[model samples]
Target chain A: MKRVRMRRLKVEKRTNPSAWTVFCISLVSILLAFVVIGFIFLGFGINPLEAYLEIIIETVGNSYGLSQIVWQSIPLLLCGVGLLLAFKTSFWNIGAEGQLLMGATAATWVALFSPLPEPFLIPAAFILGFAGGAVWGLLSTSLRSRFGINEVITTLMMNYIASNIVLYLIHGPWKGETMRGFAYTDQFPESVWLPTIGMSDIHWPTLLLGLFAAVCVFFILNRTRLGYEVKVVGQSPKAARYAGISYFKTIFYVMVISGGLAGLAGAGEVLGVHHMLRHSDQVSLGYGYTAIIVAWLARGNPLIVILTSLLFGAIYVAGDVLQLSFNLPFQIVNVFTGLILFFLISSDTLLKHKLSFRKGE
Target chain B: MKKAVLFALCLVFLLTGAIGLQAQDKLKVGFIYVGPIGDMGWTHAHEVARRIVEDTFPWVETVYQESVPEAKVEGVIDRMVRRERCAVVFTTSFGFWEGTVAAAKKYPDTIFAHCSGFMRAPNLATYMADFYQIYYLNGLMAGALTKSNKVGYVGAFPIPEVKRHINAFTMGVREVNPKAEVHVRWIEAWFDPAKAKEATNSLIDAGCDVFAFTEDSDTVVQVAAENRMPVFGHYSPMYNSAPDYVVSGQLVHWENFYLDFLSKVHAGYYTSKNLENVDYWDLLKEGSVEVGAKFGMPVNPKWKSRLGKTYDLVMERIAQMSDFQMVFDPFTGPIYSRKGAVVVPVGVRANYGHLLSLEYAVKGVVGSWPGEPK
Candidate 1:
């Protein structure tokens, strides 16, 4: 056999970029995204700067707008932080939307039908919501562990089933008598309603719970033995096996935690915002899907998920503001968010990989 | 580089402030929609009326947000009332009923007119065009044109408003062609274009030669036109989309209602004491709901003379009712459900309350409610 050596340019993985460098890269990428969206605004005969200014002013400047930002953030924060846990362990739980729906369904049932005392009702509803979501999450996780079915497909499919179940319930047995044949349930009693802070829409308990969950998840991922195991399993399953960590146990735990958090969001939304179960589309507005982007943007850091979720929430608030203020189409917000996510991913890739050129030998 | 970015951010803030100060003192009016204005259906009709309101009253400023979900309607209403200082806000969807009511309670000074909804508060009033009248007119045309004796209807949901329209349309169909049947397919969405198109194809396959829909899209009309089937548009005039197929449709002229309501406010008739009872349920007689004659009801040209006669009869009856010379109620006497049960006995007009929550499919209509077996 003739000896032959092939040589080509080799890609190399660089050391993790410094925090400051990463921050700067993110900032620049976001600015670039805005610039791109500004060009799109120009295409529509809108002054890009004026349009951008209107969004910022309407969504973040006034107190009501600020409260709306917070109200919108609660769901994203809960879902995004929960997703961080699952993504960290490489569980690929894409059924957060379905799980969230199940949670909302459970919470609504408790609020509407449960005979628990006023004090117990809210707490009990929250627990049941979490359990409903956890059970839904466990379905896909168990399927993946036992039958080796892909979690992504199962989770995504479950979303449709979950949404249909809600539709069926609203359209059938649980339909409110006074709704006049509309697809909505009766409002949750004021007893079960999450108390708002002052006259604002901010539900303090859920907001505090969301903040606490972020901190708790941050500790769990950084300072716990389970976190170590998750790191090992996510980095390499073979290494997890070598370290005597159970992949099945870790995956199950991560998904339950992830799904429980998302469920909490559903409960908060039902209790705090909607005060009733409506059509499934009206319930979540694709919060689960948006959280996926938030999780990716935060890079699995639970603490960062809070900031990123708030950013995404602001995007939503700003989207509505832009629509009302500038008469810009809703699709503009989608484009803006898409560009930001695209740039963020590209920057992350650029941070991790270094290019090299070598002569052929 | 960081300093430059900071400077740009500060500039953005300053520019926003500068623009924010350019607010006008006009009487601000806000509209909230459950679907996009480009839907060419329910929301589009309302947008057209919004434009008319803007054009008619130079002292009024109109702003609107489209495709707002029911869950977020409260916030949108709050913003419209608080941030935008809208004196009168119109929420143009049934799903927005509760939210509008809640906001009406919170902002007792701001007047709210909720369209296609039944709920009302002290500051909140309800307004809706009597769409069933036009549906009946369209059904008459469908009855004459449907060679297959099978007319298709794509319903959004099994809500009372839609059920009433279906019942009225069926009544018209049976009056003209007793043998004709109306087959209904519920798509469970208000504005899904693809699903509407699919429903149209399925109805065509099921031997329906004429079609009508309550969905918020032009897809059904487009599909019907493409397949050479006659159809009716929902909210706005959709003849431009399906010129060949469109016979006639329910044209909801909200401008008349809006002008009347706003004029009441302008004339100091909208005081808090009287606002609670201000429900404007207008029909063809009030010019709020019209047959699509203005859009040039082509009537298939083949069925023109026959459908034209029926149309003239409907118009004459409407005129008589408007002039208070006649009491011709569409839901009067001899109404029967599909199950062969008498819904409205002879010489008896159906109660308005009963009509509001009509749940059963009337005779000659071929579909059940959401949970019932098809």
Candidate 2:
């Protein structure tokens, strides 16, 4: 009777993680990270206190800045949702960046090369982008299932290959002769662009679309047959197989959904902020990689990806603010981001037990 | 453990602080380089200029970051101004124009100089190398040299900088041989050797014996030399890359202009008024530009004299020149956009406003502008 009571208590405790508690812990961790960032200022011959204040104010102080933050968060949310899907099924899709590139590639090809008219073109671009990403994802899935290769390495490698393919095309066969030596295809026609909501600085369509995706993922994960199988498979593949779940089928489904979401993100980015694909300024920002951290921080919950992506988006914007206003090396921003991701991922320890203090022998 | 980590980090901070403090009295100038200093192209030219500043001015101090992205450049400029307290900050990318403007607006007391941009503020000044005119001369040389009259060009991004270079070269090509058709390939990245080689290969395959490119790597010249084709290079003399094949180059001499600017700023004689009008020309006689230093002997000996006369005539014409202006009106009539639109009239030059905020390609170049779809 006592043993049964203890087991029940353990289960209850395991299921009862308060969101506020996690939020506070993360806040403290971020504050600690800032203290480390302060030391970076001493090297640059600036007051750390003043630099910190400037970063905070510039990133979040006013409406315009806030708008910029929201704009940056859209890609993160889209990518984070994709990350969440793959991670839930134990497939580490590290190629969200590549998937995003391929999506842009397909969308641009449709926008420029295809003769599809008006409303049909915009949807077609998104669909083609999704299909492009799915194809990329399928490559990894097949490699993992058939050859027993690691999906992570294959996916990451594919990103480079896909990017290079697009690079070659834009500069070669697709390039206009009159614009000789310029590395780009023709500009995307205006008729095929995604429509933005009424003069709002933030893209409401993307935000709403992301929210809708989250709801769909939430229902699929918690209320569908596939969701239960994914959970079981992620926890223990041997048990999942015993329970009649085909590993190959599960991997294929997870990758398709994952890549599709990432593709949607690429479409959103080109449609939302950049408008066209400029290969020069695209990759260095690491929006795709940051989404991995966002998904991890949110504990792979589709609903929580929004908050986590925004938090990361805030860091990205604040890092830029800190670098510009403080004259700090942009590398320092990478360091802080790396530290925050490290702490956030490691904080999973809290799910098991509380840290306790003991006397030395 | 915490104390040790903190102490080590603090030591690093102090060391950096000492360096920063030492920079102030020395006429501190911060340069935001867009590529690695080792890149033989764009950033290399700037670094050479920075070195010239250091060599010429004993009191001037320069700090820089190589391989910085456009999105993060604002932070570096901010730090240079507010933290390092640099008297002058030079942002060296067209994309950095907005960031520099924001910085100049926010800190009106500091001087901000941008390369290849048009944004102007009381404290902000714009400057560019004007390589297009020189490239036009090279195009003339290639036009005279090529037996087939098929010229190839390899460029980076399709920004106005690259576009103007190609367009000017094309005009020069047509000036010499109206039948000469220029073939161009753009490798998106600035300094990848493999892509550069591939682009060279593609152009070569397309029957272009004369090659020119705006790439930052030496691979273009190397590939040209290997394939035994005459190639015009961009940024710095490419004699070292390929003495046999390189005929002309558009070199950037940043030192002379950089030294002049720094000396004035250092002496406190620099004003927004003076800086705004400080558009110094990079010409052959000014030690900032040199052309045809590596133009090799042609396979046909009889054709050499004619090429020499053409070169001499071009030199004479450029000698009478003050600035390399865009003569071709891409937006005018008689010009066909790649999309078949009769955009510009034949006679009028594209005005500064349209050229600066160019959103579309003048009918020949394929691809979207800065913010178009795929």
Candidate 3:
């Protein structure tokens, strides 16, 4: 008879991981991502170290690059802060993208078609944008609460529907008469345009709003009774029920705030960046979807989202740098993003669970 | 350990950034492409032309960002101007018109040019290497080659630019085969290969034999040839993909405009403030567009024998188009819309403005045209 040896492995739930451990793990994951991407750079005949250096210098060291990062981060910060609330409530609201588009469409109506006077246009656009996104979110929430439908599928499907709505508008009644047969809208009036911080596309009104919203959300999540109920309902429905917290109500409010914030981002894109409601893709660039990564990376803390949003913003600017300077392919940047996210999620798993192996004789 | 990693990472970046920022004297020209450079159509043609521009001018250096969305156009232009110190930036694709216009306003000192757009600022110029003539030539060949008297067209979109090309092509086909119908199917996208293939198959199913297409990939050409049908290539020369079946194709020489524009910029003849009216609508006479299966060959030898009588007509048409003041044009009038209205009156050639905003389907076109006027 042959002797057989077995090695047993065990996984145990870790009660608590200190912030320091999480930071270290995140750092390790990021470094590991860079290492893998460095090999990818090598395959493309570019010096990986050189590529990293160029990205850093271009994004942080250069004024134009830094401004663009902040400009890009404004929407992300807004969306991420909103997503932080939704994630904390444990509602996987993937429809933020659709909500953002609907918000933009609503803002477009205010800017282009509204009879509002010049000075009132900007404020009205934001209000309409928020309402637009909130209403869109409510549709999904109602579906979830009434039919026990999964928000994930509904949210994702709504994105396509929202996109088609914009397409129909542009290709039909909203098509610009001055766009020379192209399917784009005429430039929004200058009064509706947001003021930018000199020479950069960093629209200050939206940026200030994002910072304000971040602080407000941070307070709401940490200081309020609703925050406590949200945590209870998300973590344990039975515990929440016993404690007299309504699951449906908590999720509904969270969905409203989340979708509204994303809508503000859409409004910002129209008023601040585009200054004209253009194609849906031209307005948002999937900032709402990317904000999921932003929120997750910040560990659902709205305050941390400020830093996380800027970091993702820098990564985007850096990707542009790699392509501009090194002639690197765009797919390589996508691979780089994929690696970071993969490692980050894996690290999260490691932080939550302890693994042990034993040799058996 | 975190601090140590941060420190090491910073050191690597600082050293590399320091080593990389050394300034060069070459006039950097940045290209903002709406599609990836690796693509086989419009972007690829421009990429190839950009390469030739780099080779032709010693003082010119080129950098480009591919797959840039229209939303990111201004941002890319900012980087190209502020970070990369690019003296000139060219925004390719029709969708980039408005963004390029806005960027042009922001950076008045930087010379800007937009392709296939009507909007032009004092600092922004517009240019297009249209394929109406080339398509007309290809249509003649398709008209001659199709036994079923039905030519299939896989269109990227039903936009005016495409409509203009199709009209000119149909005119050529009608000139050759009076009863030949040009069956068209719109993919509603500029660069989807699967859609192009399906559209091609759909046309084949509709009893059309010879094929022509305006898409970013060689899917239509490959698909048509797979079914042993003759097809015409668009944008870049795609003779290699289907040498036996390809009769002739529309080829762009974007380098001609790039070189001309850059040389003028290099010589200080064209300033940023003076480009308001610099619309480069260069055709065959300016060597901006070519009619050929490849660079040198006007028609595939294999297909030339098959084109038979219309082979001479195609050659004659090219000769007429390539002339400085050409006598003949495919759109030489007495042309009627498929709806029985005369689009072009007797002996009146379609002028530039009318051609640019075309929205009519010519006779023998068998598909729905969106945005058609009554």
Candidate 4:
């Protein structure tokens, strides 16, 4: 007797994959991560539901809380946009953090030395910040373009260099004459400070500027010929070359744009949130690294990057609430983050490959 | 198909079994730090104290993770409390304030102790030490030893804790030599070795022959020593970290403080109200705060004699103050903000509340405060 064979599940070739499916998968991943974390919490003797709720409320529940969450997301959005820009053209610019440090260092220099009036000060600070970051980015891109250096390594190394340079500046020449035995610079001048809009707890300038940055990136990535070229390069370097796009120039241009955005983020942070770029690790919130995830999750879509950033911001806010509310170990968020990112990445595997089972393989 | 079903079943069973087992543990204590435990500064100090609690009290269990960022702090705390069943938590950084406060409120039964902060709730309390007392003595060494009379300080942040230490050190410097002027470089981070070293070099180049720092790593001291400059160390016996550049340094003995708190908590005396008065001020005599290891000649002769004398005096005073009262207050009067605001008039001591609330730079301090606390 002839037996009919059942059709294999072609997970990769679905009738059509919808946004809803992606959303469901992400939600499931988050839930699964939470459940596993909940067990870990149970081992610590904590109530999982209470912990989850605490995170949600802290991150997005109330006005003050939401304001803080969004306030923190500003830097992430800026970095994420820049990273997304590089990701679009297959140019991995992991040096946004370093670039940010360079921007901060330059802005700090102007803040300390430039006697520009308030009007000129803000613009000059931003220009200097952008230029500084762009320069740092260009160096890495040029090395990659010219010497074929891997940008990931170069950018990572540059972060240390940039941060150390700031460290040296604050400690040596810019060291305040009276700070006890610390290694930080004094506060930025009031004239150069970012103004809070409408008497709100939120710094409107940073939020708006971040949104503006997102819009600008969206335009560059979607509306312009450069954006189209970037997509082609990202898809296939050889194909892009056949299409007459110069990989070296594209790499250099994207790196500069990415680094400049990061620089603006650093400047915004110094001018908007912290006002003074002290030696504190609070300068840029490691936004550059996290933005990689944001860009990837958004698939290099600038608008999606903004939303992803907000989601991360919410998670950050909620994590704090849960920590205080539940006496949760601060690392719990890291575990959650690890889980989320893990699942987010794995979701692609699920989408592309069908799971099969055998009795003994 | 059958294997897939089995895999799903196994996953469910494992998750459920794990949950069932975790439902039956005793209370957990979660501790968080801003830096790694390897760094012998803020994180190390807390870690040592945590070990004391774990070792001395067998019934109590505690766990900790280090090198957390401000943005991620809240989530870490959540996992510790909700999933781990932590009845108490300790956040070791000042940035943990708003997050910790919210956590304490959400988990009313859980207790929280925030280091170097004043925020509180019925279940949360504030805990910190008088590390500034040692800073004053450190300043004395910097003041007495500086060939250029320009001493440099490397700090973490301009927060009250750091600001107070700077003021105390400056006062110590001034007490010995009125002509001495302290220069401060803020590294803005608790631990970044290269940065700390770079700052040290910067100060050394600025004609500051004496160096000191409030950072966790001893790179600053090492940097000063490399340049043949004298340095006063902060947070514990950093002289061991830099044996060459040491005149003296401030030390934080966390065992006693942790022992006292854990003992009281174990004894059922750990309510937040009682914990308020449980603020411990460990002194040199009590072996809580040390004035550094008595050593050979300081890099500079003036520093050697002056540090010895100041260390002895501080030790003597600390020994006599059994009640932890009427001692050194860093924000004493005649203090001026860098913006020229008189923070405290001369001959007048600052109130604890005000000093703890310090937000501005003192007069003669260079540089600007960043971000939003203007």
lDDT of each: 0.84, 0.70, 0.87, 0.71
- Model 4 chain A worst lDDT run, 10 consecutive residues: A176-185
What TM-score does chain A reach in every model? 0.93, 0.89, 0.93, 0.91
lDDT of 1 by residue, A72-188 (tens): 888889999998888888878788899999999999989999878778989988999999999999999899989999998999999999999999999998998878777899877
On lDDT, the stronger of 2 and 4 is: 4
Candidate 1, residue B297: lDDT: 52
lDDT of 4 by residue, A185-254 (tens): 6667788877765433355666776788889889987788888888999999999999999988887778
lDDT of 2 by residue, B244-287 (tens): 66777676677767887777777778865456665554554455
Indicate the TM-score of model 2.
Answer: 0.63
Model 1 chain A: worst 10 consecutive residues (lDDT sum): A352-361
Report the lDDT tens digits of candidate 1 across residue range B1-374: 99998997798777755644544467789999888888877888899999999999887888899999887888888877766778889998888887888888898888888987877777888888878878987887888778899999999898888889998998888888999999999898988999898988889999998999999888998899888888888887777786667787888788999998887887888855567677787886787877772354524454467575676666665565565433776788888777778888999988768888778788888865664323
> For each candidate, what's the DockQ?
0.56, 0.07, 0.49, 0.10
Q: Kindly state the fnat score of candidate 3.
A: 0.56
TM-score of every prediction relative to native: 0.92, 0.63, 0.91, 0.61
The 10-residue segment of model 4 chain B with minimum total lDDT is B293-302
What tens digits encode model 2's per-residue C-alpha lDDT throughout A319-340?
Answer: 7665444545556667888877
**Which pairs clash in model 3?**
none
The segments of candidate 4 whose C-alpha lies over 4 angstroms from its true place after superposition are A1-16, A197-201, A353-361, B1-374
Indicate the TM-score of model 1: 0.92
Ranked by DockQ, top first: 1, 3, 4, 2
Residues B321-361 of candidate 4: C-alpha lDDT, one tens digit per residue: 43356455545678876567777889888776665655666
List the lowest-lDDT window of 10 residues for candidate 3 chain A: A274-283
> Fraction of native Cα contacts kept in each candidate?
0.69, 0.02, 0.56, 0.11
